[model samples]
Target: MKQVTEKFRFGIDIGGTGIKAGVVSTENQILGQAYVPTGAERSWQEVVPDIVHAAEEALKDAGEFMENCISVGIGCPGTIDAQTGTVVYSNNLNWQNVPLAQELHRTFTQPVFISNDANCAALGEVCAGAAKGFQNVFMLTLGTGVGSGIIINGRIFEGGGPGGAEFGHTLLVEDGELCTCGRRGCLESYASATALIRQAKRTAKQAPNSLLCTLCKGDLSRMDGRIPFQAARQGDEAGQRVIREYIKHLAAGIANAVNIFRPQAVLLSGGISKEGTYLTDPLTALVAEEVFGKKNSFLPQIRAAELGNTAGMIGAANLSQ
Candidate 1:
């Protein structure tokens, strides 16, 4: 009888601006990593090769080869059809119905799997990050926009088909701020980093003497999600107002999700999450106060994501398993 050799897995996280690839051990440790510019404006024919090359470079960094890899997993931003391994639509990449899995399979002999990047991030956290011990979780990445991922029974939940856990798109206000999705009053319109910056700029324009304006050197473009938090910490009323309003909408969205799924934990990721206690402490209290039946039911724990940007790749690597 022949003995089997242990093999590693390759994970690829594809984004509009960059593509990240890594060789992952079964224990979820990243053995090697590589990054490449996405050149998203080009056709898939041009971009797919870059993804393949990134994988090769990552394997080289790990001192391994295709034979050493058990499989390949790709986490991409889009409406991914996991069954067909196709990207139904990705507004960021302008991709529609691309056969991503098939293309990767042609490049490597190993099996290829594909899923939504946000879902992959959630899985990564559940497997190795903040939600490691939790069987059910909801992950929110508050970046340029709000991205959400859901995990149920330790598996990514895509609802009946694909593209379900869009927690950011839930309506928060009627006829409110316009969202990137061309809708109005979405949770993302108020809770995302973009929204925070917009609020800061608007407030700064009204109060030029504000600390937020001073921190930005009188340039609104220089304002970011951090300025408001920093200003609030320094006792700036405008900054405090922005932070309070941001947390209100964020809590509303979180409470809505908690009421529906009641996951074991709700994890947050992105630059804003780096605020540590400044963000989590208040956000936790707000959610506790707002979640339905919180007086009688167990409230989900809220914490920052441990894996950060690596979660997508780690989760993608485990998709084949």
Candidate 2:
């Protein structure tokens, strides 16, 4: 087996709108990278060629040949059969049972490993980011939707079959908000950046004279997740309310995960995590309060993700290890 620090790997991250590829040292350093639009509306067969092209471009940027890399690893959004290297379902890409790894392997002529994008992010963080020293970690990305990944004993934990770690889809409130997954009151419906933006818009409408309204120029279209946090910092009542509620909901979701997994660390990623201590400080306190065994057992450390967008590619590259 090749040592993690001694080899290069080709990594690809497949998203709804774009595909990002990187030539990453197994130790988590990115030597070169490339990006291309996903064109998800097209067929999976059409997209596979672009995926290969992106990898070729990244290798070119790194001034390396494809044969130099030990393997090709991919982080894709959707239900994946990792053992078979298949994408079973991907609503974002409109794909079903696509043999992703098989297609890429034919071009790269090497081992190909595939996993959910969020799972890859978690592994990347464990390899070289926020959860570097920990063996058990749970990560939640509060983006357009809440993306989650679980790592147990330094390996991605995918419950049992075709990608079962759907932490974002976990129930939060009973019949409260409709989620993108056609469910009601999911964690994503409450704790995501989209949910935060929606909360800010609601606050703006109810309190037209509040700082939130002023910040958005009285046009709700301009409201975003940051406006609430920004308003809270400036001592705005409505902004503070929005952030407070957002934290409460997010804490509930984090607390639920902690109670179940008892990971050593829980990381926050995506745009909302930029709030830093403003988000983590209060959220950690609330999660501690709500999690089971608060009085007698240890609680996980909740912190912001360090890698941002690069975590997925880096984690993907390390999958072969």
lDDT of each: 0.89, 0.90
Tens digit of per-residue lDDT, candidate 2, span 65-149: 6667898989999898989999999889999999998888778778999999999999999999999989999999899889898
- After superposition, the stretches of candidate 1 with alpha carbons farther than 4 Å from their true spots are 1-6
Task: Please give the range of 10 consecutive residues that has the lowest summed lDDT in model 1.
Answer: 1-10
- For lDDT, the strongest prediction is 2
Model 2 is weakest, by summed lDDT over 10 consecutive residues, at 1-10
C-alpha-based local distance difference test score of model 2: 0.90
Q: Per-residue lDDT tens digits of candidate 1, residues 190-278?
A: 98999999999999898899998899996789998899999999999999999999988988899999998899999989999898878
Structure candidate 2, residue pairs in collision: none
